[model samples]
Target: MSDALSEAIPVLLVAAPILAATLPLVFGLRFDRAGWLFTTLTTSSLFVATVVLATVVYSEGTVIHQLGGYPRAYGIELVADRLSTTIALLVTGTSAGVLAYTRLGGPRGNTFYSGYLLLVGGLLGLTFTGDVFNMFVFLEITGLATYALIASGDGPESAVAGLKYLIVGTVGASLYLLGVGLLFMATGTLNMIELAEAIPQAQGGYENTLVRAAFAFVFVGFAIKVAQWPVHAWQPDAYQHAPDGVTPLVAALVSTVSAYALARVMYTVFTVDFLTQTPYAREIVITVGAVSVVAGSTLAVIQRDVKRMLAYSSVSQFGLVVAAYGLVTETALVGAVIHLVGHGIMKAGLFIAAGVIALGYGARTVDEYAGLAARRPVVAGGMAVLLIALIGIPPSVGFVGKWYIALGAVQAEVWSVAAVIFLSTMLTLAYSARLLEKMYFTPANWLEDPHAPDADVVATDGGSGPGLTRQSDRARPDAVSIGMLSIVVVAAVLAVALGFSGDLFYDWLEPFVSEVFN
Candidate 1:
């Protein structure tokens, strides 16, 4: 790629989706089917752009693009480094993949695709933005688009869920803004790299009241945004009540990116040196993450609703990431990034599988999964693979992340945190095994009467929002597409395939980590 092309890629990643988002709504005035095709094309193009950007990042190191002709210190900049590109790929790839599910699965219409494209743009901007204030702007954009998407479901419940998310998400954003304000007060710059330089020179070094308060507010805000335990009440409702198509996108990327942003803030902005210099900073982060791991898993194991269970599972999965961050070692941070990507793919696949099961087999709860393998072998098998991966079984994406995180914990000699990391595997299996057993070993139960009604109705409405479908619509297999199934299989394959590439990921991250840590 030429220097100019390489420089333009990051900006294009954000701009393409935003510009394309308008095309669907405008083109809809004349053609009804424009949204899906346009959105798919746009997402696919963005994916290619991300791939190119990744190659540039690998060969040339971090790619920085300053807006207009302004220099890095004063102007808005977009950065495509190893860390950002890894996440940018996940955001773009997953958004494109989920379109296969959304195409025939309802939530159709140009307006819905408008929100979809906007969400994609927001996520990309979030990944690439180089300024703290610019990050906050992208964060709000992401939150707004996400709220609208959640509310686009068919039922009143979805609206309520979206509103709840909006309110809680607003508070989190406000706190993050407040933290940014404090940092600005302490150091007159809002640029992340500049802030990193200025923070140590603040009134009290790491112990400065302004800097300490800034960290506290920023950490708390992200804890809420990432859905850590105690502050995670909004997540279950949002995931469970959003349209099936929306659930996977939100599940896979929304919180995942927020967690990524938190990592960026901690390391890129605060730096490892800050954590070492600050009193009890590492302990507080580790404790919050450790407790979230235990609490999230315990809650997940007891939930009857599969979506809600998966929602709680994210809480635990991200807890592992957060804990890894607290470990503050290169291995642990690398593990955190790997886990973030791995968990995103695994959860996306799992949710897509759950939707397939709900739509194809009318199985939404654990009990409904009895003998699922006999009825829908491919989906059942795919889901089973994802679940096993989630349990951190060897040679799976889940295991590689956990292994490094746990190893990092042991190396740090944070014995309790390490214990939580190890114990998390068993905790994950507690829920995973229940679904696995029901899917494979339990005998199929058939209705005695061919005309018997379904015990529970799973509705698939035409509108863009989420609600329980009526039994007749829920069990219709014709609505499910082969493309959707293929995406699930692909996600499962990647989860396992990426596991073997852990060392490659670690080495790719070495230069980035060294730049930050040194």
Candidate 2:
């Protein structure tokens, strides 16, 4: 492909979704169900474009499209290197895949899909934009769209969760913006590549109080965005109460991209040399990640709500990624990226499986999952595979990422973080085993006959005229679609299949990692 065409792809990839976001709402007056179709089409095309862009990037090197042909010093740039394109693929492909579930299992409406598209656009921009300030802009766009989508749920709880996320997310964005302002004051630029060149030449180099404070603000901001411990109170409520259709997307891509942004700022804007010279910078990052791993896993073990459990699991998983960032070795960086991708895939599948089970069997809690293997065999089987993968079982994607990270920690001789990785694995096993026992071993005594007029009623005498009846508030089972089942199965297959691709990922990421470290 010509350089011009390759450059145009990023523009199209970012703009297409934002522009198409309006189509569903505009057409809703005449066609009520247009949102799904439009989203499916837009995301599908974006995925194809990303693939083409990826080919060009791998073949030609990083593709930089300076907006309106302006110079890098002043113009906003969109970059498609090995790292950004990998994340772009994840964002677009997952956005397309989740539409299948939403089509039948509603939170359906033109407005819902509009917010969905807007979220996708924001994530893409976040992935591709090469400016520090624009990153904050995209961050806020993503947050607003997420808040609206979370609030689209049927219950008032969804609204409350949305409000909580909004307040917390805004604080995160504000902190990030303040960090960007500090960077500007220190370096006189907003572009990432420019900031990278200028930061070292600034007044005090790495020790500049302005530069250190900027990193501090940026780090804390992303800690909240990524739901690290002590600041993660918003995540469980948001994930647990979000519309079933919305949870998978937010859980999978939102924080994954935020972590990616954090890494980008660390390496691309600040570079590795600054980190090496700066006192306590790397240590602080590693400590935060290690602490989150322990705290998040401990919290997850006590959660009865399945969705809430997974939310906390994310905190633990992402903690590993953050610690890998602080390790500063090539292997750790590779491991971090792989883990980010792996966790996103696994969590999306788990949440989708949760949605499927809730629809087909009306089970939501850990106890409610008893005998799930018998009731919804396919979904339960898929969920089982996902949970096992998440526990770092061998020959699975989860194990692949964790193995790299553990090896990286040992290579760097960060023994404390290494031990934390092992501890997290055991803790993850605890909760996963609880669910596994419930699904496969425990009997479903709470489940009554499908034909029973009152599903909650128990006939004390087996057929007596007046038996004692039990009262319950759970919703009745709704029909599950084949499409929903297929998504879960595909996610399971990919999780295991990608486990064998560790070497391939390392090779693919080598050029980018080499550039940053060198």
Candidate 3:
């Protein structure tokens, strides 16, 4: 125990963000600069801590820190295993990059920066938390922040979208809490490790209707949070209406992490033996995941709104993540984790890029992207690479992640699952190609005149000219900021870099995944 304490790092991972979350409320009334500075400093510090945590965990094994110096079942705990550390680093790193991008585009006008920082803090807390109730608390913090961020978007629709998300999110959280209460009642323990050990051996054969109902409720709640297929009507609206800069963050963090949490519960809290023994648990996940892939892809293909399209693509990709969890194979689960990281890089990069283009050219439809590569080669080219990666082409992170998942699907002989994934890939290519073709082949003359089509346009910073200001202005951009450009470069490089790192990273993750069975 002392040895575990000695190795503890990233222990203050939550402190930086939580402190920053409060800083805005305290000083934001006087000066916004104070809030921005606090947000930046804390988020950057959190990133550094996560990096340190990942390095230490990768080299020295897991790091476990007990919060408030309390024992299990009493205090909150943070564990920096390879998996948790990996996600922590990604979450913080992505937050830092996205926050930087949004700031460059002037997202601090509202409580955007403050809410964003708190959201980052909450997600970091959720990833590392070892206490069940602690997880729920952190989830609400993130969930509320997410609603705030979405509501802060460009128009009234954002408010509507935020309202729906808030209602549904609250309900999901309540259901999850109810399930947690049941588990606590059953075992008289709230510690996850204790519950894991104590759940299976309980009296009356353990697999009662009550326990099953609890599992169903909790899993369903998480499923909703992650935008599982039929429950996904809110995502397109949320993504479509969100500020362009923040769209990537929502797609990458909020949705992916929720799915990861569900997987964590299925494996960690209810052990595989328990879930497998529970009638229809794994099959249900597979069926729902498959339906999500198919439905989400089909919806994406018909959407003219680029943000909405990418939003649906994420739904489909995350569906694959959920399915991998349900496949009940070590390989499949590993695929899920890899895809989680890989898809985060891919989808977020594209969202930010789309935001860049939309702000620049006032183009959203597949038909309007004519000859963008000729004008802004870096942004267009970067998006092209990201879109390819999103479709799972080789020598990119997507390819590596997809390879693992496809292998897992084959191993399980889930042909319908395989078919859905495969068809979705084709649908992804079709939509992506529509964008590429518009960028490459379509003539520049086809672009709609920003002034002619819409005289009531908002001129942002990077737009037409210095004097080109409107009374009803919100944006300052005809293009993305330099900070956002920097983020795109970093994420794009990572998308390709992971292909090279695939062998080693997969090897590292393989053993950890296999441990779920033991």
Backbone clash pairs for candidate 2 read none
Q: What are the models' TM-scores? A: 0.96, 0.96, 0.92
lDDT of 3 at 128: 82
- Candidate 2 local lDDT, 221-266, one digit each (tens): 9999999988889999999999888999999999999999999999
Best by lDDT: 2
Query: How do the residues 420-469 of candidate 3 rate in per-residue lDDT, one tens digit apiece?
Result: 77887898898888888988887776325342123344433335643233
Each model's lDDT comes to 0.90, 0.91, 0.78
Off by over 4 Å in 2: 447-454, 457-478
Q: What are the RMSD figures for all models against the true structure?
A: 2.7, 3.8, 3.6
Which order, best to worst by TM-score? 1, 2, 3
Worst 10 residues of 1 by lDDT: 449-458
True-structure Cα RMSD, model 3: 3.6
